[model samples]
Target: MPQWSEQTLASFERKAKETKVAVMVTGSIEAHGDHLPLGCDLILPTFLAERIAQKTKALVLPPIPFGESWPMDVFKGTVSLRAGTLLMVYHDVMKAVFRHGFRFILALNGHGLNTPLLRQAAEEATEGTDGTVIIVDWWSDLAKSVRAQVLESPEGHAGEDETSEVLAVRPDLVDMKVAKGARVRTAFRVVSASHREELLPRGVYGEPEGATAEKGKAIMKKAEEELLLLVEQLEQGKLPITEK
Candidate 1:
């Protein structure tokens, strides 16, 4: 798993000739309750991209760290990119990746809100470059199949799912003593977003009480396998759109 940022110019050129696509992991800087790091959105995707690139032979580019973090910013220390700004950054990065001679670009996204903007960047790539780009909303795209495997009760901001993921990355970052679940008074969704703390005074939602590093490893394995298969097939000239 070579990091594009660390490779020499000549090394990059040589490696670019070896791979057909580059994988870009994108996430946001936002609060994830009191226990989880604001980087929870970014760290997991970066980890996945590094793992996936080993088998995919795709270059793992440095992750884009800012995303749509508004509303959540009320929690403090959260930074957000306006949707238009996010789109421009993604588009520019993809264009540069294409210019590097890769014909396929994979955006492995950890933050859900960035999906639409990433897709817009993909559309830009489709229309503006000779390369093809794919945006995978890492959790949402894989959750269906994985839920069957892990059997968690829906997702929350810094709940079991996210906490477990981070635990798998660094157990030291998690403080289970202070972790707690939320009280959902209704099934009704709100039209106007409330400050995150208003919803869960503890700054966390869902019961992270059950989270374990083992579950997190299983979840990540499932995602990495899917990503590896897709990249392998894409490079074999058997991209999804071309499959019979």
Candidate 2:
């Protein structure tokens, strides 16, 4: 895959200017669970962005290794950013990408909360630039694959689905011997009424009891196929997301 960070200024200018579309891959640094690493959010999107770039012909930027994760702050190693800071910094990055001459941008987001913030950044990137920006939540987009291939119930943090995915990419990071399942149905919003402790008692929200490397591979494969199709539609003027 052609990477923006690896290219010399001259080479980047030559290829990036002609490409017209680029993908900024990013995720958050937060707690998943006892069995997963703090970089779980960072790993999936960065890995998928490279694979997506191979087929999309768009330049891939180095993934942002941190994100806005207020809800998970109570957990150990749960690094987070202020919402305002994340919004402004992300907006600046989008503007910079547009200034570099890529008019179409796909912001591949790994963390869930970052999606709306990225959409805000994309709005700023689009103003006066006549560019198109879209945020693809890799996990949410492939929920079908998760349901069909991995978990029978909804997947949660460091749960069966996510653990399987990490196992696929970085199997050494998983210690299934200590893996556990946690399911909860919140009475209100997780961000507003319920914090991490009230929402996920054991630091997880989905089943991780039977996760495996093979299941992760299946989830990834399904996501790749679905996302590639979405990219094609975007090129044809169809947006993959809808406003609620």
Candidate 3:
């Protein structure tokens, strides 16, 4: 395993020199309805990180288990962080990794709200340096083709896609009997604390009843392939790959 915590000092130094790439995964403890656990965000990214590290030999940092969960804070089991706080944490972690001589930092974020902050943090951390930061919101950024094929319902918080992922990674934690879905209010971008509930009455955005572990596995497999390709591109100094 390419995990950071499990490595000895000498081993870490050697491996870090060889890879020059560090991956930090971020997630949140928030309400994912009654069927999914509060740690769904944390679990999914961590699962992907482990898979990526195993294949690419990239150093996987210990996951940041908190995120900006303001919209969902009205619900129980939701742990929210001030935007500034999460930003600083990400910036500091990237800075620390850079200090260790790793120039390529990959941030794998599981929560949707953390995307912008993660990008800002990366920008601030790598400014005026040779360091490169790659921010990936795994669910939305990777495996587009697979998602279109595997998911029938539109993507939403605690929806079909997420539910299937949970079932694939930790079936024991999912309560399929209580699984349900709700449509989000996209009429207007109303900013309110109650927006989460108003938009998703059931705390879910898509049909979880349609989720299957098989679909989750397919999604993850495709995501893993995409992630590994990105890392390979980084290794070959061919990063920032853009298509026309």
Candidate 4:
């Protein structure tokens, strides 16, 4: 399927008339340890969305690169949007998409902190439109399967799993020298307070040295397969949600 931005009106109209699903991928600009680039989160969802477009013949919209990153604002170079503002942004975008006559929306998200805000936005969008929105946090949905396949530790926020994904997508963007001395932290140990200064001084939460492009490719492949399966189910009107 052609990306929404790249397609002509006729092409888009044709696709919309044939299959009424539109996918929006989003991510954040946050610190991802010293090894990975700040665009790590942004790239993953965008990459997966492109793959999804290729697999499911769905129209892919341009990704929103900046997302909720308040928790990691302590780190230099982290760009964050307030949760409320992001939610409204999502709502407006979703409404516009729905107004264009798409009846199905898949919100492919990569950042962990953006989950709650995205969920809220999805709820509001669903309430306001006839379209069905599916918010997908790729890592969360595939974490169990990834961990089972991984040989190293996996946790959220610049962990082994994320590192592996970056390795697979853009190896040149990674600095293995910096990842060599990376430190790991646990969410359970850090969530008692909102002060990241006292909790994670290193800006990382899990081991990243064990990441490899091969492993990343495997994980991403699995994720794409699972996403296609979900898309097929959604197309058949078998989504697992009970509306209020």
The whole-model C-alpha lDDT of candidate 2 against the native structure comes to 0.80
Write one digit per residue (lDDT tens) for candidate 1, span 1-244. Answer: 6678988999898888888878998999987777888888899888888887666678999999999976576777789999999999998999888887888888889998899898888887678567888888887676457656674766777888888888888788888787777755446865335645575555466778778898887888888788888888767755657546
Tens-digit per-residue lDDT, 1-244, candidate 3: 9899999999998898778678999999998988999999999989989987788878999999999988888888889999999999999999999989887988999998999999998888889878998989998999899999989989888999999999999999999999978876676677886556776665677889999999999999898888888888777767776799
List ranges where model 2 is wrong by over 4 Å: 143-146, 190-195, 231-244
Question: How close is every model to the real structure, measured as TM-score?
Answer: 0.90, 0.89, 0.96, 0.89
- Candidate 4 regions off by >4 Å? 180-195, 241-244
Residue 173 in candidate 3, Cα distance off native in Å:
0.9
lDDT of each: 0.80, 0.80, 0.89, 0.80
Residue 30 of model 4: what lDDT?
85
TM-score of the candidate numbered 4? 0.89
lDDT of 2 by residue, 52-160 (tens): 7788767888888889888788888888998789999889888888887766678888998898899888887688877788777888866584557566556678888
Q: Residue pairs in steric clash, candidate 4?
A: none
Clashing pairs in 2: 160-207
Clashes of 1: 0
Task: Tally clashing residue pairs in candidate 2.
Answer: 1
Candidate 4 residues 97-213, lDDT tens each?
Answer: 888887888889888788888788878888956789888888877645765767377465676788888998999998877884345445564553357754555567777878888
